[model samples]
Target: MPLPRTAGSALLALALASVAVPASASSTAAAAADVRYVALGDSYASGTGAGSYSDIACTRSRNAYPALWADANDPAAFSFAACGGAKIPDVLADQVDELDEDTTLVSLSIGGNDSGFASTMLSCQYSTQSACERALRTAGEYVVNELPGELDSLYATVRARAPHAEVVIVGYPHLYKEGGLCLGGLSSAKRTAVNQGSDLLNETIAGRAAAAGFAFADGRPAFAGHEICTSDAWISGSNVHPTAEGHESAYLPAFSAAVSGN
Candidate 1:
């Protein structure tokens, strides 16, 4: 005999509830709930030119992408250990201590300082065209040869420490909008060289991150039209670091998307 209408309705509701949420969805939600995030790396990660510094010595800005993401997500725990002028050695020595088996997420942006980014930019800006070329060449060589070994080492250490963490390697943006006009920054040639160097560096980092089974968040596209020479530039007047708007709009979105696998 057929069931009563009320009994049939109850059975239908029970059947729908049983398959309402997929296993993958439930697993993802649980993983998100357990997130223990740690942000690491150099000045870019520390928000050097983004301002509102919480630590002047380290240039840890409250407006940095890590902080912004942490604020938005409300992770189970967050440790912002990134600092200005941090090279791979510095990160290995200090920042890695912040990670452990409990860490569920990690984000990093490094390798530029190791390539002498500041001096290269200074040479590009204040010195002759030849000097800019020389600086860019040296940085490019370092990125191609030496950076891979250093990045591999760093990624290994991070994996050992944060055994279960989802690592996200964030990349730098092209400093200038090529083929754009600007009053007083790097010349077109210098800007092109600098942008090329940024590309090489990001490519190297992305490769190493992939080798380590980590996610790589490319920040270049995020700052496409908002480069240093653009009318509405996202980079600070320093022409290197991103501005507050850049962090909020560019870095934050890139990182969040990477973490969420979106």
Candidate 2:
């Protein structure tokens, strides 16, 4: 499903507005004050299909995990720097200027795109199942073997910009389980491999983020056995995005993790 255009613009406008927050306010606040958060990363971070458009720019939706986190903060405390399709390079290149010394918490979900997961899924529509399987494995390899260095650099950049903040790296949701949900379309063997590969990707991400002294919010363990194919699914919207309830499943726990430093 396509994202709402109005939502994107609103978020962008909000980002521009946040650029000018008086540093004195964010910097000198009580240590226990609601954090000045900066949400960063890809589509999942933006809460695409998770809720209503947060009134800012072509970005931040009221229902977005970032905004949800902020709204539930007793007061709206964070400023979003997240965009639906952001890449590691984008974040490192000063694209999210809202991040600065005052940012108290930073949460981002990325790397899936870097592994070409979207395009691979698209290709699977036309290619043979075997080809898709290979692509999925390749995607896992890219995330595990190559994406870490990039993630390390991105995390370093954020930590450098906001030295006082506790960073949180949110991992992607599981895309499949053995045999999948598509009723006999894919073989059990293939589904098992796909899920296993996804595990590798998430493990790699969690390990790297841990090494960087950031909390890793892994959806794998929490959402395990509850992948899209399961009853009480943790993701919805035809496998691309989470349903409203799915958002709670993914982000609510993440929010708890953020508060608890998990």
Candidate 3:
């Protein structure tokens, strides 16, 4: 049975706290000799807010974390398959093919779009708190009720396609500090909700990754003190996508560590 939306947040928190999977650094690093890399996900993965776009349609950026990670590591083969507006279904249909038997590494930051996080943020930013609450509630329902099965199926597909690949599932960063003073215009209540929602999203991703035996990279700590609400914010204006620096400093390192197993 699908979990109630109201219980989703609590369940997600428990799941995140219980994660025991280590970072994929060493496992992926060892495979660097013949690595066939593929990067996948949504706007965050494509580097939407970071600018210096490589593809206008996908908003892929040369400075995006995936690009930077690839440059630093020098993988034998790399394909950036993530798109700005992708959901889990899009990945199953379009991006999964990028992973084949020879694929040595696959990293992705997904599930945010499946949860309608962008729309929830927009509703919160531009509309009433009640509207924001409603949007988030709906998103939470999707996270608990639908996202898990979708991720499980996707992971299975990837495993079937690339049995030898080391898969790293990256989670989103927290947009705001919980109850901290902030420069961003969002109200404290809104910020709290967003942070909580981000947690739920990350936990959902992490739990699924753990269950699938894929490494889960928690990006929250990487983004600590560099949230959209901070003076030296690494997240952009809407508190969603990362800035180039955020990708380089936070995401790049996190991904590198995950893949290199360092």
Candidate 4:
């Protein structure tokens, strides 16, 4: 549940809204001057489906995009605070403490789990049409109405913890290839609904990132030809998580560009 929209929360929201966009030149300079990088968020950031897991609980993987990026860049100080199945509250409790004034770069992919993505997909798979639609509707409502405030609070917490960090918010990818090449037993229409939901997710992330002056890394182009249902799909059969190839090929490049201020 979101915090009560009381006077305190309202003031916090205002302060957070002012932080949506960082000064590009200064952020770029800070990003280069020091490299105390931190990674935070949910399953995508935790490398759930990607192979070579490092921690079972967090599911940090050598192949996860964050780990790969850390390896390539060799940041002076790096903390991988993301965990499998993390929601906004989880990030607030477990991850934000990793940030500090010395932190320079941060990358995150969150809010999907909060939107009940896994449950919604299960409902779409096993429930009747009406039931699936209801589930999707609930998820969409959470994304539109509730997620922004939660994200705003979380972003504020991160910024306060590391005031100069060049934060990067990464968005989820479309899961389907369109047409009749649908994966699993989902109807084409259902696939389209799921993909649309993903678009909503990306749009929400992009908007919030812009509001906070953070860079938004889009995953769609990287996953373009390899969405689920295609022979070249980089996503795992689980559908909710990306495969190792997906992490390496899609998320890694997108995050690299974001870090480089491209």
Q: On residues 39-135, what C-alpha lDDT tens digit does candidate 4 reach at each position?
A: 9999988899887988998888889998898788667788999999999999999999999999989998999999998999899888877777788
The residue-by-residue lDDT of candidate 2 on 1-262, one tens digit each, is 7559999899888887787565555654544375677778777777765657663443445666666666666432666666666677766654457777877788878887788867776655456778878888788778867898988888788788889888888887666666635663345555565566667778888888888998888766656666656776666626456656656666767656755533
Q: Show pairs that collide, candidate 1.
A: none
Tens digits of per-residue lDDT for model 3 on 1-262? 9899879989988777666333355566665668789998888899998989989999999989888888877888999999999988898889888989999899888888888877888998889888888888999989989989999998899899889999999889988766666664678888888888888889988999999999988999999998877878898876468899999999988887886556
Measured by TM-score, how close is model 4 to the native structure?
0.85
TM-score of each: 0.89, 0.77, 0.85, 0.85
lDDT of 1 by residue, 1-262 (tens): 9999999999999888777767667887786689899999999999998889999999999999999998988788999999999999999999999999999999999999999999999999999999999999999999998999999999999999999999999999998988756778888888999899999999999999999999999989988999988989999866479988999999999998898555
The global C-alpha lDDT for each of the candidates, from Candidate 1 onward, is 0.92, 0.70, 0.86, 0.86
Minimal lDDT window, size 10, model 2: 180-189
lDDT, model 2: 0.70
- Arranged by lDDT, best first: 1, 3, 4, 2
The number of the candidate with the highest TM-score is 1
